[model samples]
Target: MQPGIIRLSGLFFLLIGSALVLSSFGRVDNAEKDFSPEQPCEWVFKISDKSLALFQDKLLDLAFETASSIPMNPHIKDRSRAQETVVLACLHLDCPKRALRYMDQIVDWRRGSCYADLAFYFARRDCIDDARRCIQIASQISESAEDWRRDRIRVKIAQTYVWLGQNQQVDEFEAGVVDSELGKVARVKAMRSDADAFHEQMQVLETRMESGNFDIMNNTLQAYTELFHRFYSDVQKRSLVEEKIKTAWNGMPISTRIERLTDLAEFALEHSDSDKALALVNDAQSLIDGRQWPLEHFIPMMGKLAALRFRTGDRQKARSEADAARVLFHAQKDTIVNIWKAGTLRPLAQAYQTMEDPDAALSLYKQALAAGIENPNSRPRAEDLTATCLSMALYAVEPDDDLWGQAHRIYQGLDHPW
Candidate 1:
């Protein structure tokens, strides 16, 4: 062959070899040529389930390893399905950290489908800025979203605002979405209308208060109290709601008194607010005395006082008040009262445990469990109390033993879908 021709032949061969090598390594010169748009959603859904299960088991390290082995950018259909699975899996695992990381990828392909889930995860993690950004993006796509899914996303956004303490946002969202006939009718129908709408309204107001919307707090409380009164028709329960609303209104400027009082009482018993909680409890007691509130009507307040006393290092007073509440609970023979009684035991047990009375705490926990079981409607409370009691007892005795196994079994037996 001629010298120039031989050189050209050699260059062509080398180029061909390079092309062959690249093909074997899954590389392509043309991006669209390599893309497979026909990929199905099922393939992505399976991978998502596996990933979510691993995450739930706290096997993130393993999940990462598996994800690393998969192709980086699959076909859009496959990618969209995979993103849905991954988003749901992250939610199930309560791992918002992972969800946030993968969210961009999901949104780049499928926007509206994952917004509600992403919003919920972000809200739960208290990632306000990111959540708002996600909401804005989701809102744009929401017009094209499914009706049920859009409603769900709106609710999630409203809840996120609630957690962020954005009272105005909550009100705006609720008034625009939730307070509509559709919203009220849907939730009311969901709860079967047997229960008062006040609980749901209170939840909204509490969310607003939590978001720091104090301006509307009193009005919300009044509205809530009226709703409670209209539903209960029981003079005592109405009076109780009225009293609580009054206290909430009175304490408005002084630090969202209801929230502060509850927090102080809880803090006094749990962490660093012992003295402050005691003082507040004293004030509450004085107020109760001044009003001559009926014992049945004032049990919850007394329970708070006892908790505050226990936190303030007043063991005797705490125990006395707890015992009094317990007696009143039993005497009333009211299922609602029994539920409160069961709730009271939780604090009493904590107090006893704090005073180094493990035996007493354990006993009270057991009693609480029994009380909870007696009222079938109180199964959730019973289950929780039983779990705590078992866990605590196990820690107090032998951590290595399978004490939690029994509690886990009981928890599994319950009908709670979560």
Candidate 2:
């Protein structure tokens, strides 16, 4: 761990300095538009939503209990996967002890990766001792991993060190990736390094994206996001990057296009660029409106669109969209599998919550939990139950005792949650 590791939110400010602080004008969400010196991290980390904090302690308790209740799968691979899922959920809930507990059960190289993530999470929270312990464990595990896996784990560790602002340790960890082009690009972003060098990296990434490789496509989008944030004030550069992103997205499937555009739209919202966010949202909306996708795909996407719409100050359209989605959901509910039903319901509930309709939100959340009960398959049921629990924990709505009890029984009942 770094000797002078500061808080994550403070480090973010230091990274950008005063010159990059965004104006709060045209903010659309319910959060106070102006950035406070006390909460600078909120602007960059969506998980820092105040609503989540309100329920954080309860969420962590439920998360730990739920994780403990899940039965271990007989197969090592399956067991590791299940543990990884719970570890990730625990991390998201800011329950590092529980995360580490589950992560220790993981039996694959991924356990090393998870440790790196835990280290990053700890670093963000300024938990230096815990972060150092996880980093040591991760390094030890990486030493015995296959060459390729070791390299990947090294990159993850390097990234964590970068987050801790430990330049010396970052250089040491990143040394293993000196020959890797992708690693180079990743390091640049992790270190908040030279902007001009990223231009060449962006070109390489864009060219790879043209090949339509899914991983490269995602990397390209992430690169665009990094560049967009880095050069947000440079209108000409931002426009050029946006144009390239749009061009790249043109060849993707309609669903993929909608998802990617909305992700960019959400990023725009984070930066208080409501106009850009709306434009991107509109682009996604047009695609959703014009396309004829399967109802299963359509409903969930619609739910997401409704939430984004509400966030962008189009509450009326958002409500209309949610209503339309609910009707479609009912029309096809019988045919939809329990997994998809839960998926669809959760987002719809989120939309309603954002719109300040607590009753509607609570009802939808209950429905989401019930949908998992309808599943005959044990694994999907367990997955759905855990996810619903996590969602309920994060949302403003408090689940009734009955709902939590039902989820607890389902988690305990599963013999193979993998």
TM-scores, all candidates, are: 0.39, 0.75
How far does residue 22 in candidate 1 sit from its true spot (Å)?
A: 65
The per-model lDDT (C-alpha) reads 0.43, 0.61
Q: Which candidate comes out best when scored by TM-score?
A: 2
lDDT of 1 by residue, 1-418 (tens): 1111111122222221111111122332232132112331111111122233321233233222222223333333333333444444444444455554554444332445355456645654556666676666566554444444455456555555655666676555455442221232122222122356545655565554443345455335534433442444444644455455555565464323433344334433433546645775675565566554444345545654575577687778878877777677567645454434444454445555555666766676565545544434323332333334322432232211242343333333444221
Among all windows of 10 consecutive residues in model 1, the one with the lowest summed lDDT is 1-10
Clashes of each: 1, 0
Give a tens-digit lDDT track for model 2, residues 165-200: 787887788774523323333523523535676577
Question: Can you give the lDDT of residue 157 in candidate 1?
Answer: 55
In model 2, the runs with Cα more than 4 Å from the true position are 1-59, 64-71, 75-79, 93-98, 105-107, 122-133, 144-152, 161-195, 210-212, 415-418
Q: Best candidate, lDDT-wise?
A: 2
